[model samples]
Target: MSVRRLADDQVQPAKFAFNRDFAAQAKVWVSKYPKGREQSAVIPLLMLAQEQDGWVTKTAIEHVADMLRMPYIRALEVATFYTQFQLKPIGTRAHIQVCGTTPCMLRGSEALMDVCRSKIHAEPQHLNEAGTLSWEEVECQGACVNAPMVMIFKDAYEDLTPERLAYIIDRFEAGRPQDIEPGPQIDRVFSAPAGGLTSLKEEPKPAAKTKAAAGAAAKSPAPTQAGKPKREGESETLGTSRPVTPTDQKDEANAQSKTGKAAASRSAGAKAPAAVSDPARPAARKPAAAETVASVAGPATPATAGLSDRSRPAGIDRPAAPDDLKLISGVGPKLEGTLNSLGIYTFKQVAGWKKAERDWVDGYLNFKGRIDRDDWVRQAKALAKGGPEEYFKVFGKKPR
Candidate 1:
């Protein structure tokens, strides 16, 4: 609800001549709707002005108001209702908007916000002193599959923790393309079944059509032939209904006849049992299995679902890549798996990872790999200490 309105001068007004073409475009946009429904075009018109000028100016709002035949206040209403419209000014290069919605909050959004707060040197909606970075806390931008996310310009950074998030923001600030990372930045696998299992099977569908139905629809043309009578010896008493074949449809005329109940019966007779476990077992919850094995903890610390309780908050660290995995010499992939299993998923998590915690995971995973070799705990210590260089100082060199 609280937004920092950038000073008017922060964003310059668009050149004067630009309005001529912008009005043309708005007219074109307005024409798309039914003759009298000009109001429906308010969103797109405002969007075009924002796109052209970087931020919406009062003059542009007036322009839209005039074009749509509505009062200026009405145009302003449409613009302000959506965060997409910037009223005052914003950083031209990077405008990072973090999601503080339920899902992102539930999965460490605040720690991510902490990274934003430190790196941008301002809280949400406040531009950093350098005028290159600004962030705002907004509602869901639809990346819940990879929650704890932020929107940088038009692209999304998902599955974030404070560590991975900090590096990502720094990379953008340094003029690096933030497109390097793939999948969600966190443990989620694009909305996997619990524990993220995958399955491919057919179930009875009451109303929904299937690939088979679609193919049938495409192939067959006329259900009733103009001249041919029902085939002799084909008694309706058979109780086997044939899918309607389009007699007019040359290609599908025979497709339906060939793939009847006989074919279905044959497939049903040979179908194999699926390998997925039954519901009532330990594997009952798929994502839960992977969640176990670490932190032997309890109910989440008392706070709202998206809110974390922080007397003193610790953040996670990121190694930048799998090659950095060796930094924690003892935390080879196997130990890493145990750590992840124990809910200790990232290096920053490992860095914030307490010594007692490391001992616990080391003991639990029976770590033959000596994680102490890389000093990941200390490395994480420095990450919580400050920015990028301080982060790399612990490892003795910066990541390229």
Candidate 2:
């Protein structure tokens, strides 16, 4: 790692203190640790400071150190050690961190850096003339599969071309960064194959009927001997008049050993009494095919069969002007199309979903618990009650 130091003295503030909200948040972070281990909060406190001021100043570092009751050097060591902390001021609107790791480098990260240099500034970590756009080349951002990516704030724009990067910079500069969706810029779903799935294309068929038939056959009773009464648990052996008793079989073997005449012993032993079944005992049944499958593989995913209509949110005719469901954080373009397909065209429809309805939609999307986690209903309610103004007021930021 390169030596990381604080900004020049002229740029450093006279002093620092967390604001009221940040102070409360700092206390919450500090409380997460034991009494004497408040120093463990130094990293989070410095991060909170950076989020508030847009960069970590020397004063902010010292302030965090004081709050945690640790030596200033200890806090400074942490801030300098982690590249996440911005020791100097960064762009107020967007800071593009280009991933220059091996994967990204092989995938045209150098061209991305060139675009940043030409558009934002001649050098990394420098802001544009407007002070709203800045960029720097950094290590991997964990999207190697979507390599040659650039991260603006928390969102990554991947599979980038120089032209696309230029267009993105312009959008951010124009104060409409949300116009460009995050993730792969091309036709890709997360890290999936860009041209669609290459393997597992065929849907799995249901369990074969042959297995069930075999199970049924195994459960059926065995055939009885010809011209003889069949008894429970009694089975016939070929070429024998009756089932041989253990003692008769042993005597026949002894007779055969002494006289070398097994045919006579067998003839004598063939007249032994048949074996009987216990009247009180019930027969054991083999498990059905479905039961056997369930025992081995557990239950099938509920999403595969889908949910009942009763749990589905009611649909409506497409309105002349439908609400943009994409504004909801978790709902992307593809997700919005899916919602539209389900007749969910307005925030009112989404906001009205009961827990069961939400669960149905969640299962249909195979989103696990993301719907609840993102609070889609609450976001829909806010957007439905009032437009973006209300959503911004409620969420303390613009709707995604």
Candidate 3:
């Protein structure tokens, strides 16, 4: 980088002030910062001065300093440090900044610079005869992906051939720069391949389901027996065998009593006393069917019992106007739809969930602990109390 200094004293203007329109814009920029830190507006104010006068004059720098109540040297340091601020007069129509970094150079940026030298002036930063065009070779302008580019004022013209750049220069010189669009000047879309996609050309197909998975999905939940109200524990059985109920237990007890009475009658008629087991040994009892099934199944998962869990939050019908659940930070349109499908449609409903209910919801969504992490209940509470205004007041930002 070359040392950047102000233009000669002879060329410097005697005084400087923002025009009426620029003064209003400067005020707006300053207002964005806190009162005591209005100095943060220095960069924008200097840029506005350049947009109005075509360059950052020394007077403009001091004027901006005074407006922001910052030291003149602090403002000068900003102007001189950023290359975006031009210290000398440039082309009245357009000042072209050609990228000369490695990527641009490897892609023929030298040829583009040669075109600029011949068309505008022999040296960089020197104005053409008509004072309507100038060119400067600058470092990367953050468009390396679209290399061999030129930035005229704020717009970038990328993917440039020497001839294309020449034509662009002519257009700007004729005061019709807007005729040419910015970005790549080729048969390409933004930084994409020049012709078309080279990989992943075929659309991906969804994975085919295996026979077992297909059969499992096709099978619906077993229907409850007719003439019986579904028991509380029965609904949580998933696709396994029906759970042992209180009615089943009572019937088993009655059958055992009848067998005992029959055994007593047989013993009364027996010729000899029935054989007794030795005191030191005990007979092994057979495991009940329920016990066997329980051992095989291990334990019920959340998905199996989610619908019948006591801790699950109570859901209500959709109101005349449902609260926009998307207002919560973590709930997008898709998540809002999922919540609606569960009959959750109001902020008050969400806010009322206890920790157990929250865990149920978290498990239902497979969200681990995201519900607690995002503080959805608190967010919902704020919205429930007074809508967005209250939410923003509590959180210090607008609801997502």
Candidate 4:
């Protein structure tokens, strides 16, 4: 860290006080901490001062010190420690901080600095001719992936070229910084591959099924074993299914009779089930006797095989232990429990959710697109494959 101080011989006003709204906000901030820890509101109070005066002035720091009942130097110590506070004056409209770290340096941040020189003062912290724009080169803003970025006030503008930076400066000088969007300047999501996703591009789409597969699916009976008798001690597996009893058969018959004419009419128009094909095979000679294993498996579900509303997802099994879903950036303990309740107990399950399923979950949880915003699918995919190592390799950082 470098030395930070107020301008020498700079005279502060005789008195300073926050406006009505800021005074209320300041009290709210001070009230957040314990009784004796009211001084902990120093940082936010300093920020409030900065926002009011557009920079941290000597008088503003003193006012904040008075508000917190701390020594004046104590407030000065904090104001100078954080680079976020501008000790001196700034451009009236905007102060741009260009990132000059390794990533931005490699991505032509020097070109941005040159643009700043031509537009604003040759030295940073000095206002332009119109006194509306100023710029300084700073360290990385943690947007290394979208290199060559600059922050104007509170918002970051990334993936900048010299020409783009020039345009941004012009807009700010013209009192119209809102004209520019604040992230990548191309058709891409934040920090994603510029050419689009490289891995995990195989999200399932509704593909047209082959004729054979479609016919096979149609011919598969919904009651292949429906009428079969359950031997002693047989049990049901599907929650909604049960063995047919005499009472059930009688009720079904009565219901059919009630709608017999409509049923006949509908049956006349319904398409016939497709035929099944078997390939020719030669008979095999029997040699050894094989022992049969008794299945401890629960009762089968044949009536609801093709009905998605009644069928469980194929090959999906509840794990003996759930994954740590809180590893995802936006997921906390409460969110992890919500996902578990939704049957998303594994990284693979979260990774496999397509847009439709994600939308459903997002709506159910009232997250409103937070999944896409945090790129949860991408994170879950990496976690599902190789845990921490894969996550680090893919994202260039560890999972949360």
Candidate 5:
């Protein structure tokens, strides 16, 4: 939005000179944006002017306007907007900038303000009669823990009791070098540990659904006949699953076995112990399976038939497990979720794409040469079940 000219201040030239090295330095600010955006560099250019002169003057504003091709009024607008630049003349030697935000205010910042009024000057931006000190109340300085603090130029002096700030002010006025001390002057650390934490305890593993507490088999089966992969009449589609059965004496053996595999580990070092039988006393039967599942989100139908052949993504041959289709390399959890939602769950689906479909996924997913990078279809087909276990074969070559 375009700003209006101030009713009080006029578009006059700056009183101070923007020196040789300073003008050269000002060009660096203009370089940050694209061409024709040089006008956008107004704030920084004015700042450069303020740095050259103790406060921005009419001559400095005019210099910045000319340098950045901005109007003199527009340059003054930029100068007046930021609190950092002082528009009035300042002391030749020192300035005390006291913080007035809530934390600093709570920590006796008012006392520091009092000190400024008593020892330096009473108003926000005026120099003392001696011309060696000046003070103003400002905002949070990113050092909230060191509340009740003041800044001298850019360096913060924190944890002020009125006495401490008085001492600091005196030292600055006396031409003494105030070397910064390590750590906060106050008792608090950098940031407090986050509150409402509910998940840090070392939870015990629930008895495995397939094993007992000890993982030893309970009553070693009055062995019943086990069902094979199903018949022609069976449901082929992955269906909504049954509720969880809390592990009992019977599933103990599976627990001790700890056979669950982390597919990504890909080597022997990744495997856990074999399923073991339970030796503990028998489990007392209690609540139904329905209750167990409600404790957490109930399981949905297994993703088995999610996107097989007829339902295959337009250009890909198979489901794309998320990790493979990242925006940049090293895709993490969020990118994987995006791929899964787009129904591009496996490498095969991503690998195989029609030009149009590839464009849609790339644009929809906002992913940047994804489809044409590799022959997704052929590669995916190779990874297809009953095809030559190509996923393992291809990704398996440990590069030299």
Candidate 6:
């Protein structure tokens, strides 16, 4: 490793502080750690300081040590140890780090080094004539599969020929590095087959049905008979029994007595008043059978099931007054309306969401962990109570 120290007094500012933009970001990073452990945030602060000015400077290191409340040497130790922190002045517009590892070397990285030497300076880390560009040969940048790559700041330009590398440097020097796209120079995706995918080029065939699945299908009753199937160990008897008990005989006698009285009254020529069926014996309207729309596709996932339930079908009435769902930080007007349309109107409903329900909503809304990330339930509970007063009591501030 090259010697890493603060630049000469002429090169560094007398004092350094994070600019407003960086101050705000630094505050956020610092807040992530527990109290009195702010020193843990030193590495990121140093990186931010370096990012603010093209590289780490003496004043920047002291500024970070003060911000983190650590000793100057602690901050300096970190700055010197990580190769990522450039201790000297780097090119203001672009500082290129070329990978000179074995894989890159084998793939004509030497030619790239030659290109750098011819175009910029014979010594690495020296600025070009314009002072807008500088480069250094570094160890493996971990994109060896895309060997012969150069990283300008955060972006990696991979699969470079000498001509391509020269073009990239020229573009950066001209203050338009954005003109050159990153990644493989040839037609390929990151580390995939160079030319194109050689295998699994077509859609995969459906897996063969297992014997257990086939047997289950065979055992399933026909659709018409889905309502009833024979119970285990029961005979196929239709309204037949072995013998009558004493209680049955008594019930039969009572029934005969009622029939005799009715016959006698009819035979006596006495017209009985028009009769109505007993309310207790009135005909019943059978309930509709449980409907099943068998999908030709396959079994439903829990996510899909939740989506189906949450999707409001036509003819369901919208609530007269929907709750203000935007009280939750991430719930913008469009998302609130979407939630309302899906019948999730109130914060109470959102607050009640379990992990499974949240997962379902996440899938339904095409969100990637936004619910947990924003602590939607915590916010919703506060909103449902009344407003952010309760939220402030719990979380110490207003919702984002």
C-alpha lDDT score of every prediction, in listed order: 0.64, 0.85, 0.87, 0.78, 0.62, 0.79
lDDT of 3 by residue, 110-178 (tens): 999899989999898888999999888888899888888989998889999999999998898888988
Report how far residue 108 has shifted in candidate 6, in Å: 2.0
For model 2, residues 186-229, the per-residue Cα lDDT tens digits are 99999999989999999988986798799998987655556554
Error of 3 at 103 (Å): 0.9
Candidate achieving the largest lDDT: 3
User: What CA root-mean-square deviation does each model show from the true structure?
Assistant: 24.7, 9.9, 18.5, 24.4, 24.1, 15.8
Q: Candidate 6 lDDT, tens digit per residue, 218-250?
A: 989643233455454322232223355566667
lDDT-better candidate, 2 vs 3 = 3
Candidate 3, position 284, lDDT: 75
Candidate 3 regions off by >4 Å?
201-205, 212-400
- 10 residues in a row with least lDDT, candidate 6: 233-242
Give stretches of model 5 more than 4 Å off. 1-14, 181-183, 187-400
In angstroms, give how far residue 209 of model 6 lies from its true place: 7.2
**What residue pairs are clashing in model 3?**
none
Q: For candidate 5, what is the lDDT?
A: 0.62
Tens-digit lDDT track for model 1 on 149-264? Answer: 88876677777778887777777777886454644765555666435545654675689788999999787643334333345333232322354344434445455677686688
Which residue runs of candidate 6 sit more than 4 Å off their true CA positions?
Answer: 202-400
What global local distance difference test value does model 6 have?
0.79
Candidate 5, residues 1-400, lDDT tens digits: the string is 1232222355344256668766665666677779998998887777777677777776777777887787887887777676577766666666877888999888788888898899887776778988888877777778786677777765667777888777777777777745544335555444433242346557677664765634554644333223334343332232213332444433644544554554335575566789675778565678788888776766664333233334434533244333344422234558667666665666556545666666555556445655456444545554553233334334321111
TM-score against truth, every candidate: 0.46, 0.63, 0.54, 0.53, 0.46, 0.57
